[model samples]
Target chain A: MYLEIKDLTVLYDRAMVLNGVSLTVGKGEFVSLVGPNGAGKTTLLRAIAGLVKWEKDTLKGTRAGRITLEGSVKFDGEEVTNLPAHEIVRRGLILCPERGRPFREMTVLDNLRAGAFGCKDKKVVKENLERVYHLFPRLKERENQISGTLSGGERFMLTIGRAMMSQPKLFMIDEPSVGLAPKVKEDLFARVKEIYEQGSTILMTEQDVSFAFDLAGRNYVISKGHLVGEGTAEDLLADESLRKTYLGL
Target chain B: MVEAILINGLVLGGMYAILAVGFALVFGVAKILNMAHTAFYMVGAFLILIMTIMLGFPSLPSIVLAIAIMGITGSVIYKLFLDRVKEHPVAVMIISVGVAILFQEVLLIGFGGHFRGIDPFVRGFVEIAGIRATYQQVIAIATSLVALVAIRLLLSKTRVGNAIRAVAEDREIANVMGIDVSRMCVITMGISAVLATVAGAVVAPIFMVHPLMWMHPLTIVLAAVVLGGLGSIKGSILGAFILGFAETAVVFLVPMGAFLRGAVGLSVMVVVLLLRPEGLFGVVFEEERL
Candidate 1:
């Protein structure tokens, strides 16, 4: 396995967000986690990306409740559960957070440049910039525009493009299609497929079932912080309870 | 008389700009209302005094040494104290205020309560725009301009500068992008301290240095920062100059106006807040503020 998570659990002041959830993805594989709202899908991704630990460390005494995270996350055969988010990114595990947060005050170009912050080679950054531009021509066209002013779909595209600048080993995207028009969502879906076909390992959590089932090679169904079902789309869909209760299909 | 006011106001505004920019930078980047900021300014002046007058070091090296020490102090303070309580704004403010008072008391005990002064880095007067000003005032203005321009370039043109801005815009997202948010905050605090120390070092010759001097300037910086809208660097600079000119104008126009200068500056800030709550150049929405 290129990425393995075992017995992962997270708690916010005793409210269990994720409970003993485990999953895996092989190199160059595309995996999707499909679940309803508050199903711990996002939390699972955040734990893998080390953001849950970040919140736990930074917001220790504030109004935010105490967070307890447990489990092992091994990436590229190294345990990364204790690493900081930036350190995790240094190892090529990049998380494109939900909501298309494109560093709102920055220009489209600067946001992409920031995405390549860890890579010191100027030539590599330039090459990544060209690749991102090739992947999303809209970003190149609006390179000078402030990201906050971009349309919802454009913002999502910019978010994904920004992530591509980092040269990810395992790209984790959380809820990319949220709050997007169907046409814009379709464009993003196609772009994601192209990114996967270009030989990248991907793990995405999404609420849109059809969107997830169509693109991902393997799928996992999660509900109330537990892994309810896992298999290929056909095998999972064949189960009636998972389809009716978890998938809402 | 008008020329004197214009020249004096410009000089005062330049000093205030340097002072308020540091305060605003920390607030903008770390969301910290560091009450100890002006205290660090006072410490800078005292360090210069100790190095040049007491230890007999050259003026230039003393200034450089003072700034370096303050920068390290700023970074340490953030890492050790502020970083732990950053999430609670009220706690952060209280702790910073305690730090300021601690500095004041330490200075009072060490140097006594009397005012002291340092020799100006430069002497003599120069005529500019039909007005005569001391070389010290000229240095202050020149230093302010250079610092502001350098800071502008650093923020807009460099990779580290872009990362700082990104951290300021959204810290969590910046972290996910592989930028170390804590390191950025520490660097910002160091820069903020360096700016304040430079202001203190340059102005120590013109202004009397005392333990209590920080209080008045802290109030003025608070007024400037609030008037300009908190966390906007350009707004803080503009607010500082506006208040600087307002205070200078009051000193020239009002009867016994020298004592009323602080009041006039604060009243201007209040009026501006009443009219435009966000302050000039400040983000209007709460969520979008830098």
Candidate 2:
């Protein structure tokens, strides 16, 4: 497993959010975690990002979980969980969270610079920025404009572009399709798929199960906090009972 | 009659601008009112006084040393206390007030209960457009303008400056981008402390340095920030100057005397709040709580 979770449990101020959730993602693989509203999907992703408050709550199971990135987390792969969120990004495990917009006050170019924050090498940052601009030429055109003024579709693109600035080995996006029009959603997903094909591993939690499964090679049906089922996207798509019960087809 | 009042008003307005700008910087970026800031200004006065009177340092060197010491003190406070309190807004507020009290006691213990002053850096008056303004007051105005410009450059031009702005806008998003929010917060506090220190140093020659000077300045600083919109640099400066001129003009024209000048500031603040609660120039001033 390129990325592994063992007995990971999470809570939000006493209410149990995730209970002994375990999963794995292979190198360069696209994985989708599909679930309903309030089904602990985001909680699991937040837990992996270490933004979840762990010690404040109770845990009955072995909360011992490990995330091993082929090397150390960064190019020199050392364990990065103990580090702060910024350090985790420096190690290339980046999360583009749901509904979180770009820093509205900053210009688009400045927002892009903020994304490449942990990279000590200016060259890498410049190269990554150029590549991002190439992928989303609209951002390049609107580089001077303040992020707050950007359209909804543009804001989503900037968020993804900002995450890409970190040059992550694994990229996780939560509900990228949320709040976007159908055409905008299609454009955003196409960009995300292109990013995935460029050798970065992806783990995404999405409400549109059909679209998510279509993009991801493997689908994990998450319910309440457990990984209920996992299989190839085609097998899971073909299963009628699983689709109706877990996916609300 | 009106000329003296106008000149005095301008001086006070400039002073208020200096004090409130520091408050707004910390509040805007770090989201901490830093109750200790007024105390830091008081400490700046004392530092300048001690350097000039006891240590025999030159005026420029004394001011520089005061700013440096206060910057270090502010950084230490951030690392030791404010960093831990960042997530706890209410706790930080209470703790900041406690810290301010602690600073007061420390000053009282060291300096005793008496007023003092640093020797004025310049002597005599300048006739500007046939208006007689003391050289010290002119220096204060010029120095403040220079400092404000420098602060603007630091906030808008530099990389760290941009990062600080980014953190202030949205801490979580900045963190996701890999910006060290703690470091930015610490730097903001440090800059605020330095500004407070400079304000003290600039005004020390004209105003007496005493243990209780902070009490008077704290009111003005709070009023300026609140009226200007809490956390806006421009708002703080504008509010400070407005209160400054209004109070000074009232004192000069009414002859209710110098002692009542403090009440002028308080009243102006109250009036601004009554008229525009969002402050003189703030957006999201009230809704920020939500």
Alpha-carbon shift of residue A221 in model 1 (angstroms): 0.9
DockQ of each: 0.83, 0.45
True contacts kept of 1: 0.82
- For each candidate, give the TM-score of chain B: 0.96, 0.94
Candidate 2 lDDT over A1-249, as tens digits, reads 677776676645456667777788888899999988788888777666654522221121223222211112222234453466666676677889887468887899888888877876888889999999999999999999998888889998998998898788889898888888999989888999999988889999999987898899998988887778899877876889888898887
Q: Report how far residue B147 has shifted in candidate 1, in Å.
A: 0.5
lDDT (Cα, tens digit) per residue for candidate 1, span B60-111: 9999999999999999999999988898999999999999899999999999
Give a tens-digit lDDT track for model 2, residues B222-249. 8988888877889889888888877776
Q: Estimated TM-score per prediction?
A: 0.96, 0.91
Show model 2 residue runs off by greater than 4 Å: A54-79, B1-3, B86-90, B285-290
Clash pairs, model 2 backbone: A72-A77, A72-A78, A73-A77
lDDT of 1 by residue, A1-249 (tens): 999999999999979999999999999999999999999988998899999999999898765849999999999999999999999999999999878688887899999999999988999999999999999899999999998899989999999999989999899999999988899889899999999999899999999999999999999999999999999999999999889998889
Q: Pick the candidate with the highest lDDT.
A: 1
Model 1 ranges off by over 4 Å:
B286-290
User: To one decimal, what is the Cα RMSD in angstroms of model 2 from the true structure?
Assistant: 4.4
